[model samples]
Target: MKQQSSRTEEPHLSNVENPSRPVNSARNDVFPSSTPDNSSGESATKSSKSLWTNLKFVRLFMAYALATFGDWFDALAIQIMVAYRWGADPLIIALIPVCMAVPGILFGSVAGALADRLHKVRIMILCDGITIALTVGILFAPSPAWLLPLLALRAMMSVFHVPAQQALTRQIVAEEQLFQASSLNGFVNQCAKIAGPLLGAVVLAFFSPQICILINASARLLSGAVLWPLRRLVEKKEALVTDEHNEENQKEPETFFKQWQQGWKYLRHTHTVRNTIVFGCLGLMSILMVEYQFTTLFREIKPGNESMLGWLGSSVGAGAVFIILLLNRLPRLGYGWGLGGGYFLIGAGIAGLGWVGPDTSTAWIIMLGLCTGLGNGLFMVTMNYLLQKETSPDYVGRVFGIQNSLYSVVLVAAPLAGGAIIRSAGPSPTFQMIGLATLAIGLTGILFQRMLWSLNRRSTSSEKVGSAQQGVS
Candidate 1:
């Protein structure tokens, strides 16, 4: 149980679910979305069916999910090998996220801008291919020191992959189905969370961590293959979009540095993107501050239970899947409620996890896991939808890049501080402290929601007023 918990860590980390860059540091599979203002006009009965009909998106999702399938194992293997096999300390465990985050700080914005300037599908494919080599490199990593650098490189590639994947998602899915598409992607990640760990646990019981790492590498290789057809589809689609625009409609090319600056500018001027980034980063920082320490608690919970980490993660995934089902049923769930409520539940779950000890029953721990999962489903979906909906398709890649960069900046410090806290105060107290902080951050989001809503109201009113004025003139 003294092992660090990677299940939560995996969401933001490169190998896990996806979103906001791995260190996903906060979200997973945010691969991007398209939008129509609302889905009200759509046939209610076939809400999800409409999305399934898009064979291209389905194919991309399956391949991305396949790549994501492998994500669960790499960190689990590394954490187990580091904390259990290598007998590393909390500080060593802290380095895992730090390495993952550094790439974001260094390359997140650059990668994002690159995603926009380059062919997105090609960017995604290339990154996926590069990751195969990096993931395999982990197998040969003899120690924590060696494995961390490999994880960082893998993360570096993901910074590029994420924005490209997201931008491509925007183009592939229709406007009205954006939310549905995002929800479905979240579902895929949840399923991976559930299945990846359970399968990994079974594998771990019989084999070495190296075996699991190889399994992850193979998944990526297959994922890259699945995307080959998709690359052609996306390229062809873009060509058609380009053809529709006459010469005058074509965009004048901007220098790469200019495009990168424009992304920063867009993030700064756009309230929605700015606000979401703030919440996403803080929530992520709050979670990472103590996420890696869960392994310490697990050791205390069940001696020699290597699979407890996976089970705990699986429980979270199960909770998320249940919530995802419910959210899909609702035609309209306000972003504010979704985000605010998510923070509260995740905080509550983390706090409850703090209270667990050797005497705590397994059922109660699983229940807490459920709480976090529920919150994750809510927060992650809303975050993705907000970005997809509010962002101009033009700046999607840069917006995510800037956001991931911020995530990396936080990732740099949160784990180190968390490790220090855990080393000093132990896991229980550290969890309790960070959990309350996250709770407060979640509560703060209520105000953010109000401001966001008011901004939308004004924006809408201004548009109507301008239209009326024009008519009168």
Candidate 2:
């Protein structure tokens, strides 16, 4: 079994034939020209790393953070609008996440491929523009029904926006600093989550939900404005043209099925990519289902569902913010344990929500909310760091696209399932079941860690032994 596993492994940096080459020689062929330097590389590498450290990365980080805030605010506004204004039937309420997920599954491959070929910033700007227009469309629409399709389209735009931004990060940041960049982004995302929901809820207190929607739209526009300045900092690489342009038509167009087939082929062949995608699919499904279901759970616990849902969600967000703040202090933690522990806690907390009194005091629910948030926040940061570090830049966008699509699928499915289960068993048992499932998944992650680590270690050791024997000969 060990030998079979060992044969499938790929080369990582610890397997050097001449360890001194990276230090002694001026030319380092390991990374492409886009990798940032650490003051040790040739002039370009040094310059690249220098750019990575400056205000550009900071600005881009803030831009995305603001955009994410807008996204979440819109989500809160929609839920409030549907529940309070439009009347909340389970199926109708479920349509929100479903709308978001459908486009992602349909458009992921095309969007990912485009991200690789086009300028990432330009693509992001385009998404922002379209989303802003959609927001305006929502503003003019006579009713909630008119807004659903627009929201769905906005979700599709998000699919492209995220991967493009992630790829752009790789273009500017140095390899060693990749983890730092990922952590920073993760922290910012959590901060946005913490602030957006709370702020949106506050806005809902005074203004009509429709006005809040307009503000969310405006925030997207502002986010695009912030990102505009980073266009120069992001160095553009000539795209790898996998398809020849048809001179007569001037379009390199492939059938949708054919494009999807190509994407599957790429994913199926790449082992680590395959694993990452699977992990993301499974993980995201659990996350989306649990949170969406919480809407009903909150309703059962407190008569006023919308307000309770927003407050509980905000509490979870607060827990996430706390986790992000602790990342710097907890650098010694391993990703495997950290992520596993997070999943476990989240599952356990949500399950415990059932045990909280029928009175549903703010104190106990708030505590559980914190646990749920912290666990999810930790898992997001660690898992993302692992995947980004493992995959090569060439396939990052496509792989992430697939992952995002799977995430959307899970998000869509979970709420429907949650609603069904809640209706059947009531909130207590439903919460318990979700909690158990989450804990089991976390346990599975923890149990599988040894296998993955063993494989990584064996590969490293084998390479060292090979180099030693070659040197002796």
Give lDDT per model, in order: 0.68, 0.61
Model 1 lDDT vs. the true structure?
0.68
TM-score of each: 0.79, 0.77
Q: After superposition, how far is residue 356 of candidate 2 from its true place, in Å?
A: 2.1
Tens-digit per-residue lDDT, 1-473, candidate 1: 00000000011111111111111011222222223123333423223346676666666777778877788766677778888988998777767877887898999999988987888767878988999899888888887778888888998998888887776665555544666767777887788767787688788899998998998889888878877775654331222111222222335555888768767766655555677788778788888787767888677656777766766787888888888778776766666677777887889889888887766776887898999989888887777766765555556688878877887788778777787888888888778888888888788776566675334333221222223223322
- Candidate 2 C-alpha lDDT tens digits along 1-473: 00000000001211111222221122111112343343444434334443334465666766776677787787788888788877768667667667877998887776776666567778888888898999888777666678679878888888888777766665545454555566666776776666777788899899888877888788888978977765544344412222232122224454544444445555654444465457555655565555656655666666654566656677777887688567645535554565567788788788888676556677777788888888876777666655554444444566567777666666667767776777888887877877888888777767775543222323222232223222322
Model 1, residue 325: C-alpha shift (Å): 1.9
> Poorest 10 consecutive residues of model 1 by lDDT?
1-10
Off by over 4 Å in 1: 1-49, 81-93, 142-146, 234-252, 297-311, 357-359, 423-426, 455-473
Candidate topping lDDT:
1
Candidate 2 similarity to native, TM-score: 0.77
